[model samples]
Target: MTSAAERPLLFLDVDGPLIPFGTSSGHRHAAASDSSASLDQGNPLLERLDPGIGPRLMALGCHLVWASTWMDDANEAVAPRIGLPRLPVVEWPDLCADAGPRGLHWKTRHLVEWASRRPFIWVDDEISAMDRIWVAAQHPAPSLLHHVDPTKGLLDDDFSALAGWLRAVAPSRVTSTGD
Candidate 1:
C-alpha cells in the first residue's frame, strides 16, 4: 500500500458536494429534524449534510483537504456533522479582476498549485472544460476534475467514479468501495 504522503489528494468542496441545495423541502425538513446534537443550529444548510459521507470519503484512502470557500469553516462546522477529522484547508488567493483564462474557475489554478504535481482529485460544483484543459496542460501528474451536481450533492455514482479513477491511477492505495 502507498503511504499517506504519496497517496492522491482529494480536494473537497462544501456548498454542492456535501450540502445539496436542490433537495426537496420534505427531505430538508427530515434532515433538519434529524440533525446531530453537535451540529450548529443556526445554519440550516448544515442539516443537509449526510453524516454517512465522511466514512465513504475516508474509505477512498486519499488525503482529504478542504478546498471550499468555507475554508476553516468546513473544519469547524461541517466536519463534526459528517465524522471527518480536521483536514488541511486550501488557502485561496485574494480575487482579482483577472483570475484566470475566461470561463476557468477561480479555484482551479490554486488547487493545481497546491497539489504541486502530485496526483490529485478536485471535487467541486464549478469545474468547467477550460479548467480541465488548463490542468491537463499545467499539471504533469494524474488528475481528475470531477464536477458534483449542486442539486444532488455527492451521490453513489460520484463515489464510484472517484474510486474507479483512483484505482486506475494508484491501485493499491484505493482500499475500499467508498460505499
Candidate 2:
C-alpha cells in the first residue's frame, strides 16, 4: 500500500462537483425538499450531495483534499453527509493577490503550490484552457485538471476519467476493484 504522502492529491470542489447547482433538472428542488427533512439545516445545498460519490472518490486511491470556497465548512457539513472523513482543506491566499495571468482561475496557483510537484488531480467546474496551459508550463509532474459538469455533478463518466488518469500516472495505486 502506498503512503498518503506518496499518493496523488485530488483537489475537489464542493458546489459544482459534489453539490450540483443544476436548476433545469429539478435537482435543486428535490434537494431542497430533502434538505428540509435532513439534519444539516444550515445549508440546503448540502442535500444535493450524493453519498455514493464519497466511496467512488475513495476508490480512486488518491489523497482527497477539499479545494472549494466552502473550505473547512465542507469538512463540517459535506463530509458527514457523504460518508467521507474530514480530509485536509486547501487554504487560499488572498484571491486578489494570488490571481495569475488573465483567464486563470484564482484557485489555480495555490493548488499548484499545494501539490508542490507531487502528481495531482484537480476536479472542478471552472477549469479552463488557460489553467491547463499554465499548469503544463509551471508544474513538473503529471496532473489532470478535470472539469466536472456543474449540471450533472460527479457522474460515472467523471469517475472513469479520474480513475484512468490515476492509473496512467501511478499504476501501483489503482486497484482492479469494480465501482
Candidate 3:
C-alpha cells in the first residue's frame, strides 16, 4: 500500500455531492443563500465505502480534501451530522465568494483559482451548464475533475456509475459496492 503522500487528491465538496436529495440518482437539491441547485450526490457512493476505496484511492495516490462551502462550518457540527471521517478539510484558503443562486459561477471561479496547477475533481450539484464545458475545454484530462450527479440521493444507477468512474479515473479509489 502507498503512503498518504503518494495519493492523488480528490477535492470533495459537500451539500449536493454528499447529501441525498432530489429525484434521480444523479440529481440532487442544493439550497443556497438565495437560490438552490440540482446536482449529483456522490456521498452515497463513498459512504461506508469498502476499504478498497480508500486504499485504492491512496494506492493511485489520492488525497481527499474538503472544498465545499461548508469548509468553515465543516467540523463544528455539520461534519458529524453529515457522516464523514472526523473533519478532514482543505489547506488552501477559500477565495470566499457567495454562490447564492448562481453557484455554478462560484465553483468554476474558485476551482480555476484553487486548483491552480494541480489536478482536482469537483463533486457538486451546482455545476452550471457552462462550467462543465469550460472545465472540459481547459483541463489536460477533462475527466480528471469529475462531476458526480446524484439527481436523487443515493440512487442505484448513480452509485454504479460513480464506482466505475472512480475505478477508471483513480483506479486506487475503486472498491466493491457498499450498497
TM-score winner: 1
Task: Give TM-scores for every candidate, taking all chains together and pairing residue i with residue i.
Answer: 0.88, 0.87, 0.56
List RMSD in Å for every model shown: 4.6, 4.2, 7.9
lDDT of 2: 0.83
Model 2 alpha-carbon drift over 4 Å, by segment = 1-5, 24-42, 176-178
Ranking by TM-score: 1, 2, 3
lDDT of 2 by residue, 1-179 (tens): 23435799999998778978786656544432344344455666676789888877888888999998777877878899888999999998986694979999999999999999899999999999999999999998889999998888988888888888887778777763245
Of the two candidates 1 and 3, the one with more favorable lDDT, higher being better, is: 1
Candidate lDDT (C-alpha), each: 0.86, 0.83, 0.49
lDDT of 1 at 23: 62
After superposition, the stretches of candidate 1 with alpha carbons farther than 4 Å from their true spots are 1-5, 25-41
What is the overall TM-score of model 2 with all chains considered together?
A: 0.87
Q: Which ten residues in a row are the worst by lDDT in model 3?
A: 32-41
Model 1: how far residue 29 lies from native, Å: 13
